[model samples]
Target: MDFARLTGLIAATYTPLNERAQLKTDVVPAMVDHLIQQGLRGLYVCGSTGEGMSLSSADRKAVTESYVQAAAGRVPVIVQVGHNSLDEARELAAHAAQCGAEMISATCPSYFKVTSVDALVDSMQVIASGAPELPFYYYHIPALTGSAIDMPEFLQLAGKRIPNLVGIKYTAPTLFEFQMCQSVDGGRFDIVWGCDEMLLGAYATGAQAGIGSTYNVAPALYRNLVDAIEQQKWDEARRLQLVSIEMIRTIGRYPFHPAMRCVLGFQGFDVGDCLLPQPKLSEQQAEQLRSDLQSIGFFDWAL
Candidate 1:
């Protein structure tokens, strides 16, 4: 996809909220600015980290509009509107286009069996139909999608079948799918590494950029990592990678959303806590996280 040619520090942003868990739309602009100032190349708004599943349809649109408007064409903003509900996804895609997002993305429908390659292709086609002019990349996250698309099936229609189908945010640990994507028209399709911990490895495997959850915490460090890779400074990249390795692997297995909520709280944003089906980090753990961050010298001033 032709999405700003964005290739570094694409923050998977958080949707800030008030104490009521209502959409606190105002917090977005400042957050986006903060990341930009910290050296972010792009913003991946309304994604898994943004707690899209925790938002209402209209709220999602508002959040996307708020960020896109705040960005004001300064940088690329990718709106992840992927949801099981086609109606919601379409609404979000249209909202993103109206607000001037560079690209739109969606996860395949899940929670029920959506078997067959035809189903995946058809669903993606429907998503692409929402904003035909802008490119749409399929979000490959089988664990969250509750469905899987074999590599052959995914590569077959990434471009030939769907004209605007540009690239993919391949999220799982399996590099095999990404390798297949590289094999099948690497020029047309931009493959982004979605796993945070394996970013350095993915970068070596032709993952031009990465969309990740932890960028909000330390964007500069990631920017440094990317730069180090470009400069062939493997040691620097490994050091920063070590700093963020914990959360990338363990977030999904634990009460991560709430932990991120706590981190944001410490960062001075009133993003509040995670809703039901997501657990909050323990007060002790949260405090220790802050302490550990201080020890690592991350966000000392709490912007």
Candidate 2:
């Protein structure tokens, strides 16, 4: 199937929660509306930013359904259904298909660690089989997944094995490797760039699209960056990229995702806190984070 390449910024969305940190899906519609208004091109749900691994399978499905229903076909929604268990991942992929998601992506099982390109292909094959009709993009984040199987080789092998294989959510900083992946099969795949801080580099290296956590709060900044790149405004593009780097650095002072959720709260989302293992910001920390963000002029240009 010929899938239209995903372009522009796709927000790896935050899963809204109430005070109890339970699934507060009632906010999904408002969140979706806000994202669309902010100029994000698509929605990527239940990925690392959404705390997919921490949530129960039931919660993941609920989140998927809420986002899909709220989106109402305004934009494409790509569901990330990666799990440690291949069987559960397959089930999640099928559920995403039934829920009307436009695409599916998954990470290789991280616990046991996939050591070979062939094994990586086989693991993805099991997950891709469940949603054979949806386009599959391998979610490659080696820093988190610990499976740094050579992507160009995996794409080469998996292209023949997985019928719905489309591309990759390439997250690492290796631009050379990313370029090689793009060249595979004469550039047939839709390789969406995943690192937010390095977007300018990716665009210069031929990235048509990007998916990232930071896009949720700062869509306009990235849109401007992409616009500047396309218009050959080299100075403006570099400045914009530096702004993003600074923004990420400020957020990195705390547990990154929780601090991001705090930023979301500042934008009036009521997204609550991240799950237990990820850590949450204290009131003092939240205050400090807000001050830090302000110091960087985040409120001026972030929207």
Candidate 3:
């Protein structure tokens, strides 16, 4: 399918929330400014990092609107409109198109678990049909969705069926399958990598773009890694990727989304905490994360 080639850092952004855990639309402009200043190429809103699944449909639309407006065409915005309810997902995809989002993506419905690759392709085709003009991406994060359909096979099968099937947000760590997906159709699809910690490995496997939750706060580090790869500075790339791995490891010690919010607060923006299902970190826990990050030189590396 014809689509813009997405490259470099695409941050899977977190939703800014208020004290009452409401959608804090006011903070979006500042968030946009911060990301732009940090050298992010695009924003993937209402995705896993943004707590998309935890939000109501109206709230997700509001968040998407806030980001798209704040961006004001400075950078591309890929809105993740996936939901267990295909109707809701279609509504979201249509809303994203109306708001002028650059692209749309969706994960498989795990509630009923897509039984086969054909079924998966059928669901994606239906969702993509919502915004036929925009490029459609299948969010293949099987680890979270538990939809273990073979992605390379899915790409080969879905490529013919879904006319707008542009690519996938490849989050699984299975490098072999990832490579296979990239080789399909002479690598015509935009296979954006999703694992932040293994970004260097993804690069070696020919990933030109990546989207991740950690990129929300530590974009510079990833950008530097990308630059290093471009310059053929393998050692420097390895070192930079190691630093990112260490940073992700540090945040992994706490509840991921909450710890990420805490990190953002340390960097000067308070996006608030993760909502229900993902518990919020206590003040002490936040402080500890700060201390831990400081000890590991996270501030120096990421900032």
Candidate 4:
């Protein structure tokens, strides 16, 4: 296991698509350059923001390949391989390791959800074993998974069963459980905060890193947020956190995925639309979104 600590803003990137919502692997290089320019610490590919669950396994593999290729050792790439099927998740995990992804992460199986901590640990162990060489982080986003098992307990059980388990993408709102997870085994795990809107609260609990969709659009704001909090500049950190919360709330008025894609389009990526069932913004809506963001000074705060 590589055990290298993942810190700072790890952007949960959007999967670039063509007008037909096909994977536009070609756009990844430009996307990489755009993020690097924003000073992101790492990339979290094929996760919630990337619409990983909506994509076919082949498409996920292709996106992972494109990101690893484009990053070209510039930054660490953590690939999310969680799927409803353990075999499919294992397959993707294997492919991620083969392609040189720095780490692999997975959320609970949602369709036939694992309701018990032991069951969740069993599920995670199988997935982690597939990529034994790479560091593995269990993605704990109960809001989406509905697993709702106690995370602190999950970590205690998972730590013993899965040797490669290094940390978690701690996405739940329960900060008390989050604090317990962080303090497990004398702060043994690297708990990266996943809720973008309430990041300051997480930072106060000793969260050194975060992963979020908003980081894709405004890396400077979050990078500065991290700096401000670290420097004990509470006033500045609070202000930045409010701006982030407002920006997310504004874009979230529409279907969040599509609106964020539109925001990226505004950033010059032309990453295209979110896949169907996720909804696509009309050109008029997209224009209005851009105008609204501008009115709120998103561009000014954005990198």
What tens digits encode model 4's per-residue C-alpha lDDT throughout 23-105? Answer: 98999999988888788889999999999999999999999999999999999999999999999999999999999999999
lDDT of 2 at 300: 94
Better of 1 and 4 by TM-score: 4
Residue 87 alpha-carbon offset, candidate 3, angstroms: 0.8
lDDT tens digits by residue: candidate 1, 91-209:
78888888799888888777665687778888888787888888787888878866776855676765666777877888889887776786675455677788888888888887878
lDDT (Cα, tens digit) per residue for candidate 3, span 176-291: 88888999999888899999999999999899899988887888888889999999999999999999888999999998888999888888888898898789899898889999
Ranking by TM-score: 2, 3, 4, 1
Ranking by lDDT: 2, 4, 3, 1
Off-target runs (Cα >4 Å) in candidate 1 are 1-4, 247-254, 295-303
lDDT tens readout by residue for model 2, 140-217: 999999999999999899999999999999999999999999999999888999999999999989999999999999
Best model number under TM-score:
2
2 against 3, candidate with superior lDDT: 2
How many pairs collide in each candidate, listed in order? 1, 0, 0, 0
* Candidate 4 TM-score over all chains jointly: 0.98
Give the lowest summed-lDDT range of ten residues in model 3: 1-10
Mind sharing the TM-score for model 3?
A: 0.98
Mark the regions of model 2 whose C-alpha exceeds 4 Å error after superposition.
none
TM-score of candidate 1 against the unseen true structure: 0.91
- Candidate 3 residue 175 Cα shift, in angstroms, is 1.1
